[model samples]
Target chain A: MQFNKAMILSIGNELLIGKVLNTNAHWLSGELTKMGFIVDSIVIVKDDVSEIASAFLSAIERKVQLVISTGGLGPTFDDKTVEGLARAFSLPLVLNAEALALVREKYSSRGLPLTPERIKMAYLPLGSKPLDNPAGTAPGVYLKYRGVHFFVLPGPPREVEAVFKTSVQPIIEREFQRIDFYEALLTIKGIPESEFAPFVKDAAERYKSVYVKSHPKGVELGSPVLEIHLITFGIENMSQLRSCFEYILMSAKKLGGEIIVLKEPGVKL
Target chain B: MQFNKAMILSIGNELLIGKVLNTNAHWLSGELTKMGFIVDSIVIVKDDVSEIASAFLSAIERKVQLVISTGGLGPTFDDKTVEGLARAFSLPLVLNAEALALVREKYSSRGLPLTPERIKMAYLPLGSKPLDNPAGTAPGVYLKYRGVHFFVLPGPPREVEAVFKTSVQPIIEREFQRIDFYEALLTIKGIPESEFAPFVKDAAERYKSVYVKSHPKGVELGSPVLEIHLITFGIENMSQLRSCFEYILMSAKKLGGEIIVLKEPGVKL
Candidate 1:
């Protein structure tokens, strides 16, 4: 039951309109990459019910074992992800007793009246396991259907992070075997890509699994900058990978280009 | 011909690994939205040639009238976006004289040696138009085939922004009719979403064209915040849209809630 591939669905129009920054996707991607999971793709759709349903179908078609959706879980007109999910899977929407109890307690703790609208948060797709959200009122929903795991988390970054760390990560770890992974980054500045190609080519030819990428940084002051990155990953032991990365760095230094920054694991920037 | 839809393809693995932030996509989305163009989606893929080609085909299949890809125009093993674009369109890669001249001048201006690898920046898809990149060596590529317009931009934020403003924006504007749109945001705190549902329903019912969306924000201490946004478009005039938005804001205020913040055009925060 190991989940090798995942798809992220971020539901929000604010992101499309640039009203809010999308830090949730970046944080989730980084966390999953560190855990040795391959994120296939990320899709950002509006809060429309049809769009959510269509995105879900597409993720399933892509064969992503785990589909994580963030947003559209609140008690508002546009918060329809739960309804969409249920409709997509042909499951019924019912009020869960545990979720209702959590909602009531959450409102009571704040000395606020448990209004009819607040009760809406208790509704969940049939057969979903509710994960407690201590940071927010909206509890995360986890559903498994036809061998695919779908997680619905609240939109807020803090709430999403808290729920993922406490509930989702544990399940993922338990289900998937541990794999060794390592990554290295070398940031070069003020070097043309052509002048740096020979060194990069030599490194790539030496290491079969290593990948070198050049990002053309726009001109600064009067000179252009190109950030050359060397990335390597494998499922076996990481010592050889670390050694290969070190050798690449040493070669890059010998090439005599302006190296602005270098960052790696167990090393501070 | 009016280009109403566009898809952005960001080429880099640094984005996936969290080594670099993707500010280009955000900036491009905002700029396109302001110009009355709907950005259907954004896909960030690795610099792998096959992946880039597959993504290009997918974007075309999605029926987006315009496709803009950023990155992979440099002279390295990973800089394969241009080649991928050529292969995707079944066109041969040819060195454009204007593009070569631009590269030479850029290197000579900076007192840098122009190596053979640097000439790779001049190679582009056949029959493509070269757009000037004053800030970098990689000139933007513009190609129109089978009614799809493709614009290839350098990855650097500064160069991309400069080239887009100076060269691409005018061409796009000339080819499309601008539409009028407006959005309003109201940040309310100290109230759960359930308590605010009825108010949103009433407002939506009153304004047929106004779309109401609620984003649950978990940033502020003590009480969770919900950002209620009202977006309206397809109006004949901008002033009418502004007046309509003002009335909606007034209605939201009458519902009796804690309004944390409100922002409007020509008004400072």
Candidate 2:
């Protein structure tokens, strides 16, 4: 369980001020979940170096195996995520020649000179490797610290996806064998969430292999709509997952609940 | 600075698994920022009680003045936020009579009986006051522990907004004087973000009252477009804020940058 535990840390002033909606965390969590990792926590901190370092340390203290952080990798003054990582491990920031070459190549192709700000992107914490960013100037970072895999990515949504796909995903795939992950959503109407809660609890308890949770969409007592989500891990229990889902649906229908929609398998909402 | 610092905690299994986008944290952060509180950090943890309690303890340890947590206030077995609060403070979970009355009234109006599942929503941590939820059945919890004001809100977005507006907002208003807060975005094209970073750094340094950060919307070296975000606080520095913004725009224009759009004052993002 500890080996497959992951945490996401999003760092930026924009996020702290609520100017950005932290889509990066959500995207990373979904990706990690699909890869069979249980995302333990998602923490957002300001651009301040101490805060970033403290957050990283706390994740390590909690024994989080994979820690992926986004934002503050730019060439601006406010960009301090790399420095924060260095501070966290008490590692020296050194210019990695390979990273410098990558940065140099990107700017030179554009007929641009390598300024100090541009070169700043080459600095990496000791023993950390740089991941090539296919879509951005700043190279993403990959490090192993205190038995935790740390991937530092860029802020923009597009760049996050690009670096993650090219660099982060491969490393994750190599490190962990993919577990069988399954999830399904059942949308029902006519019954309040409270009334449906007991059935969900009973199904979850009886199955022991499935996790069931209900979300109330419509009013409690008036035109009630509930979304029941069921999930399970492990390859041998696929039948158990289906039966658990069916049991809940049947119970709901018995209690005057009408099935509104059942999401197609492998479709995420 | 500590007097006006706040932190947001979003607790749920769905959020951890990326089933939900955590719009509640973003929305709450925006509201808190508008009220002049510097949102220090936003942390999302699983619905597990120990994790929830640990998050609360960390925020208190950081000396955060206000902590608003949304999610896990429902009839389900996974709704352990209130219990987590009690665990963090070593307080007992007591049946809140006022909250029970609120729940009773809502169910009685719908001609529904008070089942144990519905009654579960009425329990609160000792010494906690229940806030009326206008949009949902479960009432929000407001508590003062270790000199930090904690507002425990429900998961659903509509219910969160309703409880926040009807209950949390007034308490915050009464406790703290609203500071004048202003933010503006400057969208520019043609110059790259790395090229524009120094100018932003210079403007931020030259204008001590202003905070300037750049977001690259377009490619780094090809057709670069950067959105410069400027933020400031206080009522007396309005003129300085204007000059600071003008200085950045003037500098950008001088560097072959085209002003694409300037957001109206008081507009966010």
* TM-score attained by model 2: 0.97
The candidate 1 chain B region of ten consecutive residues with least summed lDDT is: B260-269
Lowest-lDDT window of 10 residues in candidate 2 chain B?
A: B260-269
DockQ value of candidate 2: 0.81
**Model 2 segments more than 4 A misplaced:** A1-3, A264-269, B1-3, B264-269
On lDDT, the candidate that comes out on top is 2
Worst 10 residues of 1 chain A by lDDT: A260-269
Residue B227: error of model 1 in Å?
3.1
lDDT of 1 by residue, A34-119 (tens): 77667777777777787688778877787878878888887777788888788887789999888888878887876777666777
Clashing pairs in 2: none
Q: DockQ scores for all the models shown?
A: 0.47, 0.81
Report residue B87 deviation for candidate 2 (angstroms): 1.0
